[model samples]
Target: MSDIATITAAPIGSFTAEVFAAHLASLGDAPAWWLERKRAAYATFASLPLPTRTNEGWRFSNLSGLQLAGFKVERVDPNGQLLASPFGPAQLNFINNTTVGDGAGARAELAARGVLVTTLSAALQSHPDLIREHFMAQPQKLGSEKFAALHAAFVSDGAFIYVPRGVEVPAPIVITHAASGSGTAVFPHTLVIAEENSKATVVDHFVSVSDIPHSALRTPQFACGANDLYAGHGAQLTYLAAQNWSRDTLSFQFNSTVVRRDARVQSLNLHLGGRQARHESHSQLQAPGAFSEMLALTVADGEQEFDQRTLQIHQAPNTKSDLLYKNALRDRTRTIFSGLIVVDSDAQKTDAYQSNRNLMLSDDAEASSLPGLEIQANDVRCTHGATSSRLDPGQEFYLQSRGIPKAAADELLTFGFFEEVLSRLASEPLHDALHQLIKTKFKQ
Candidate 1:
């Protein structure tokens, strides 16, 4: 059975040279170095073994559901149109895996303030030094090395934002990564660098272009993605990611965040779709007073399963980190949240917290939470917890007594449960937009 799963996921025909060659041929005037990197990445992709049940990081995940057979990396659907962002802020729209149009609109002032918000490929040429310094510099220390290798092998078109020293952008630089056709594989990458004393927001949106049409036969939406964020001394960066793939998609996204002296970084990942999805996040607080806030929200139903693994490393004195991940499970859906915090021996006064909470909406649903901490600093303040719970029957009844439908009542309570986390977003517009997005997701 495991071999069969591997056959479905590590398909033979999909990783062929002809397919990769065609992808490279389409990239007009690509740099030689990047091409070489991709070539090396492809070799790594082929050599790496498929993650099996024996892998400790993949524990509690349904390995058989990870199927990549019949998938191919192809050109975007030429005939398909991309959907607009539902609630408008600053928008960058990608149609058929290509960023078709983008507009800061009223937020154009951000560009005037010495902020460079452009596609990663564009940024590579325009701001080579910064991209060279930060892009994928962190090693894949997490257990998703295979997926990271695959992402490196195929990644194209993603956003790269650089905020100069002491410049603060009022608006979020939004990036949308849309996968259009079935059996179509895309690699989306994002790199964010906030210089010292700068403040900015970056949002990455991954969605299936339901309005698009596929021109080819036997295609699927199979994608691998990665995002790297660097916060310089005293800089503040906030990142929001909303991932919604098609039901038939197999997806993996790896996120690496590095925080420097006195810098602060807050990131939230929201997962709403995909048949099988795995997200790995790693944060390293590398200097004194650096802080990181990691948050995620997932809605799983219809046999969907989300596996998340996270690590918070405190490498310097007085650094801090707090992680809060909440999952609401319905039907036979399952979710796994495993997180750890490690404090170095010299990192005295380190403060870390990790919490995973689950709200069960169906009797058959399952949610697993594992929170651990390795504190070598005896003087540090560290805490970790996991709570698996159900909707409060009283709370449900209270809403129902107001003539609310049971489903709506449950949803309302679920929203209340998530509101605590959403409230963490300091941006009012962003908070409201994400809240409305979740509400719309529930309606669907």
Candidate 2:
């Protein structure tokens, strides 16, 4: 029987009505509309079953080790620091869904320009209609429908940003989410709406507390996060996210981008930490002359598992999209990449490309790739390819002959492989910071 058919009617996770009730109580007097939506979402989540190995979308994933127990709705005190700092003029620091610090100067300036840089709760009260229209508006086309519903049911606070028409922000907006306490479950959401002819950049950083007193006895955390990006006509948006969860943590991040006429959006995700991490990303070109660029880089080591699924949909004519994902594996780690490109019947003259490449640094590491395309338009040009390769022996030997250690030589080659994706970032500071974080992982 098919995986979807074999799915049991009973839910398989730890989420129950009691947990949902506790989560609702934590919100404390939120808008009625949002509360009603949450109740509906919780029902949906409870009805859906966990994904099994028989599911094609979850092929090559480590479903046997997937567990959703031992997590609770908890708050983390802010540590008065930004995990990803100095890259943006406007910044919001969220530790376990609490805002601890912000850039007042940048926020004030953006406010003067009629931009909205505030928390999701605040936006729901101040701009109820606007938030209702754009928040999680897109369908969860990927295989994370249950998780997406879970996010909506429990998510309390996150960053909300809106760029007005004809306005351009000089710097990026940063949102940092950190989990400090063990077993602290966090739901972080970022909603961005850029108006016509507007331009902006957003950075999301996920990190865990370092230097645990007991260290070895620390329990793992759970992070279920989502982001929605909407680019209006003639607008441009650039989004960057870096996930560095604790090594014992389990994380799920879903992303959706909608592009309008003459609009463009570029998003890059860097995955570095987690015992098992899964990411789902979908981009839709809703109008003519729209473009979407999707990029991702992952470094997996020490029995870690990174699974990524992506989709690009061309719903209109004269649309374009490009996707590139790269992964480097060491030790006994595993990585999986699955991507698809779809061109609608009316989406003529569409140009789409998808590629996934993996580099193996150890014989024990494993990587899987699945690339597909569906084109109903005869005039569309869509191409996809995936490749898994190892470092050239000659290059490695040459570096070793120059007194470089074998480990260092491999690290250098890995960096060279990843630079292709990192070089696309427009912000110098953000680029450098990402590079440094990758280097730290290599050192570890």
Candidate 3:
């Protein structure tokens, strides 16, 4: 049998090749220009080589295991359960890469206001214009172009959210993606566009339907995905994402948020699974008064490794961006966080801050942080800092004195430590939901 290790050459006529071909053929006859763009993107992807140690954006990233040597993308069958992962005032679910659960006449209400919430495939057939305008619109310049290309090549389904101008969603929207098969490869994309003066909150959850053994694994599937957030003038957008892929898979996620004039955008990502998972996020403050807040949390256990990199660019004067990422490492796991803040020459009065803090739960775990800044505007205030340390023994002891077990004490203290970031979530239900998810992590 030919194994992944022995496969050195790319096979153009493989099953995935046919799958990609079918994707192109089934496009409901899109504009020639769009199809041409897809062809161009595929060509670019096939032409670019994987990142190496010398690449600055990939520095400190574990790249050897990123080989496309194994795995084939396929459709996941019917699966998923109504997991009660702390719900907010509203909820939406995506089970096994498909939509599920309709609550509170939500679909009708959104439709009434011209807000369209539908599957990516359905939207591809119905709202081709929207997809044509914003699908993978931004340049993938963050050094993850290879994975982004893979996502574009194989992606067939995802969530499409379009908030019309001046519409304000009263409740937060929830989306969940769960894997069911033993060796499943799923690609989930979320594209959200908030028009002028609109407001919306979207929470995305990625989970596994079954708990695969981490220490003993057979086939290691790959998870390649992307998310895009577009906010127009005076708009407000909040996104909360939790990634809980199968414990033995390779995962890559690239997310970008574009903030327009006077727009406010906040995104929070939580990482907890996969043998080797790398996440990259980029946010651009494109105009004056634009603000962005980025928050991320990771819990690395066993031999798992979570690598994360981020960038915040103040492209216009008086723009602001604040980033805070926290990680908790247990067992012999490893994590790396390298981030940067850039203040352009025209970005006068730019206020940008970048911070990464790690809480070590075991002596064998490792956490690395590198924070930097490039500021060309003399009048801007830009700062970056990275810190890695163990849990505060004093705080642990204080909780223990109150009759809490040592493990419980440590968990409680850790939760308190993360509250500062979680509290920033404007939705109470989302904050509580995230708190519950973190609580379950300590029990594992």
Candidate 4:
């Protein structure tokens, strides 16, 4: 098997054909079908070119900062402790795509209750059929198909959760993906399968260990991650992802959600770190009475850029989807939000709404929004809108008159603005934890 040094001379970044061969060799005794899938994914990744400024899907994105070269894939030993989360005890931690810890002490009980929480590698061997059925099954309708293929080619292990029918997990399952070494590239995958009438919540945290200082020549890190959420009939699934990579990391996250008959899925993403980050979310209501609620909050500061793209497809009649994305931009940061809602010809009585709101904190910051809708059914009700605004001077003055400092007043106002999204969460603890995470980002 070839190592990183041997493949560094190849032209296709660190993910050369030689590197892919070595990756396949590392997965000893893997099934033939899975291996073939990886080979095909790598081929797809290699054939696609990087996105250019002319691409409509990548409009207003900082295409110059996008780089697929110079990053190496290597396992990093845990150097420091993983950040603690107040969510619950069921947690899995990974450093450089290698599982380091599994804290699900309630595993036995969960297992008895027909809940399966394990690493992707383990699930591949133990539950091959389930893994094959839903792993990266959704198409990359939004942009970032190349990155998604790269993730599938290089992904080794991640969190895999399966909740059987009628089982309701009492607590949220937490998964942490941490990058440790400089120039290290990690592919994180999370697949949650909630069977009919089941209920579960999964939270994912992406962080960098021993983060390098922003003043120094920051080493470039790469993180390409994806998650698949499947909610069966009458099932409920709630997913929350928090991304806080290092200051120099280039991050890409793709989410695909499938809501079946009478099922409901709610997903909220918190973007707080990385020099350049792109997130694509696609939610499909495949059956009647299905509903999807998509929410996101981004804090872009100090030259950071966050690009978000979303698509809501109503495939069946009486389906519903609602999307609300808000961003707070400061300094010279930039943010882009592009979203579309599609109602199929047979999807009558569909109700869909999309909104993008930005709060500009600095005159130098830039925020771009594009909201659109495609309705083939006349009975559907769909609406899309975008708005960019600054903090209200009256609210600032009112807070100042109440003895709050200028900075404190601004923070309070921002929190008040964000509370609209956070209040939707049923778990108050998770909401508070996310609120504190946003506060910490402001201090940095």
**Reference-based lDDT, each prediction:** 0.81, 0.87, 0.79, 0.89
Clash pairs, candidate 4, are none
**In angstroms, how far off is 60's CA in candidate 2?**
1.2
TM accuracy, model 2: 0.95
Candidate numbers sorted by TM-score from highest down: 4, 2, 1, 3
Q: After best superposition, candidate 1 residue 76: deviation in angstroms?
A: 1.9
Q: Give the TM-score of candidate 3.
A: 0.90
Question: Model 3: how far is 14 from its true place, Å?
Answer: 8.3
RMSD of 4: 4.0
lDDT string for model 3 (46-132, tens) is 666667677888776676666665565555445445555455423456654556666437767888888877778777778888888
- Tens-place lDDT digits, model 4, residues 333-409: 99999999999999999999999999999999999998989889999889889999999999999999999999889
Q: Candidate 2 on 1-444: residue-level lDDT in tens?
A: 343343454453556788789878888768999999999989888887788866788899987555677776666555665554534433777888787775667788789999888999889889989889988898987788988999999899988999999999868888888777778788999999999999998898888764454341245888899999999999999998889888888899999999999999999999988889999999999999999999999999899999999999999999999999999999999999999999999999999999999999889999999999989999988989999999999999999999999999999999899989988888888788888888878877
Name the candidate, 2 or 3, with the larger TM-score value.
2
Q: Comparing 3 and 4 by TM-score, which wins?
A: 4
Q: How many residue pairs clash (N, CA or C atoms closer than 3 angstroms) in each of the candidate models, in the order given?
A: 6, 0, 0, 0
After superposing candidate 3 on the true structure, give the runs of residues whose Cα lies further than 4 Å from its correct spot.
1-16, 22-35, 80-85, 88-96, 100-105, 211-220
Per-candidate TM-score against the hidden true structure = 0.93, 0.95, 0.90, 0.95
Task: Provide the global lDDT of candidate 1 against the true structure.
Answer: 0.81
Q: By how many angstroms RMSD does model 3 differ from the true structure?
A: 3.4
The window of 10 residues in a row where model 3 has the poorest summed lDDT is 4-13
Clashes of 2: 0
